[model samples]
Target chain A: MPSLKNIAADLPPVQKTRRVFDGSFMVLLVLTLAGGVAVGVVSGWARVGQILIETFEFIAMLAPKIGAGIFIAATLPILLPRERVGRLIGRESGVRGLVVAAACGAALPGGPMMTFPLAAGLGVAGADLGAMVAFISGWSLLGLNRTLIWEFSFLPSDLVWTRYLLSLPMPVLLGLAARAVMQRRLA
Target chain B: MNILIGTVLIGSGAIWLWWQLPNDAWRSASYRASLDTFLFTAPRVIVALLGAGFFAELLPEDEVRQLLGAEAGIAGILLAIALGPLTPGGAFVSFAIGAAALKAGASPVAAIAYVTSWSLFSTTKIFAYELSFMGRQATLTRILVSLPVPFVIAAMASLTG
Candidate 1:
């Protein structure tokens, strides 16, 4: 078993207040509110109420998984610190780097909020552009948690499997392509 | 059934991670971080889901069927790919919309194309997160290299199914 990297204990505790209502959240809120109003106008206020009620019921059903996901997202970063992951990934080149980068991206359980920062940090830690692209692509296409928690819930099992299998090679292929493009520019 | 399986797997993983925390201080800090994340994520999930539900209700089923059904073929796949980047919000929003579209008689190929396209090129993800973090040059490179993925996946999927 990998020793739980206890390095988080050594760092000074952060006291930053994370705002719940940022520009992204506001965008989503406005879109939802607008959609709700449209439903009221086109269908009826009763339909809007029913939709709201149903959405809440769906949320209730999803709460446990969401809680678990949030925990993994928060704790994983601490346990597997960015510097360590960057060191592990940054030194590699060619296919090996792409594979490692993709593996990290797929295995890491978090949303974009966590991933983009990690990718940026990886770059600063000496990862090449190709590896970074692979990392982001891997997370976008094959993130285990998102597939398990959300995709399986929404899409049919066969469809999900097909997509997953097809996507298994994408990150590496994209990484190679990114490298090729970068080389072409230099040439 | 899917939800149950997912919840159990993720729940166990969460427990294992919690057990791995070294001591009381680390555990407490982890707890605080998780709570903060939950606070940030929950509202977005709620709003995104609500928007998905409302938008699903508004979908013109007849037009969807005409455009994306089995007979619609390559054109439908192209249309689905085109619509992917335009979708706003998070993963759930795209998945929910995909589900609703499938219910409305869209073909499986179109749905796969749509989901794949959105995953790679969603404007929301690009504009809000990727650009700010990854820088414009890297972001453009990723997007450029990934531009053909959905089409390739869709093509292969159609061949098999």
Candidate 2:
């Protein structure tokens, strides 16, 4: 029989698909148009007129957010220097970096959607797996947005505080667990 | 003109409330916290809407529900967590879907898990941008780490329920 490495190498190459016109994109477009039409029909022509006006207002509100996202996306790679991020939060071959990785990850912004790309880029630039895990877990578990929203609403003060307090330990735990898994995988 | 006038009136009332509030009270804390939350989430909401527009064409609700329905059990929960990275809508849309799933007799834990996962992850986003910036290892690591979080959160929620 052929060697394991030779066998692995003999596997067929996977085909890479084009990025555009994926199933999800088509679905999103249909939903938006359908939603627009539904809104227009439900509200009537007069309401449609108002909606048209409101749409412009909504677009105006959206402009800044889009700009901010672009800015954040652009700046994150630079803001958290790759070497420092790696050293501080890198998922190295060792275990100590795991805890550090988790703490640093939780403090970063933009949630998994935004951070995933950033983390991947950082990894390319020499960041470690530990840091990336910390970052992902941190973004998911921590909620700067929810904390702010809950504080503002009519919700009970203690309830919101309790949730935040409870959530605080999760990022650390997740980071540690990930590190343990990684160590085992490596070993 | 009426809309403009109403906007101005609302703005002024908001200002009046700000002016009237004591600087350090619980009410002030609540208002500040809410404002901060709005500021934080507002951008994500925009991203979600754009993502919704992009993803609306891909997965239908029926398919989503079918995949993660009550009949699926832990498999459904795992599928929901895995698929979380694919969803693009904000909490409003996610919550609406979760409510519908609950009504359809999906386990409360599973529905909550789906919502939490959807809120936290998106595969389209990962492939489109994250991988480019964070690199494959980091991107993959993050995705792997996030995979189980929703289940844990959902489990906790279920326990209370």
Best by the lDDT measure: 1
Highest TM-score scorer? 1
lDDT of 1 by residue, B33-120 (tens): 8988888888889889999899889889999999998889899999999999998878898999999899999999999999999999
DockQ of each candidate's interface versus the true one?
Answer: 0.72, 0.07
DockQ of 1: 0.72
| Candidate 2 runs further than 4 Å off | A1-30, A41-99, A111-114, A117-127, A143-168, B1-83, B89-111, B134-145
lDDT of 1 at A1: 20
Q: Tell me the spans in candidate 1 whose CA falls farther than 4 Å from its real position.
A: A5-16
Q: If you assessed candidate 2 against the hidden native complex, which CAPRI class would it receive?
A: incorrect
Q: Output the lDDT of residue A11, model 1.
A: 56
lDDT of 2 at A11: 24
Writing each residue's lDDT as its tens digit, candidate 2 over A60-174 gives 6434433333233223332333445655453353445555554555544344444555555545555455655666655555543322321212123333344345456666665
Write the residue-wise lDDT of candidate 2 on B69-147 in tens digits: 6567678888767655555534334543444455544565575566557645655556666667666655565567666
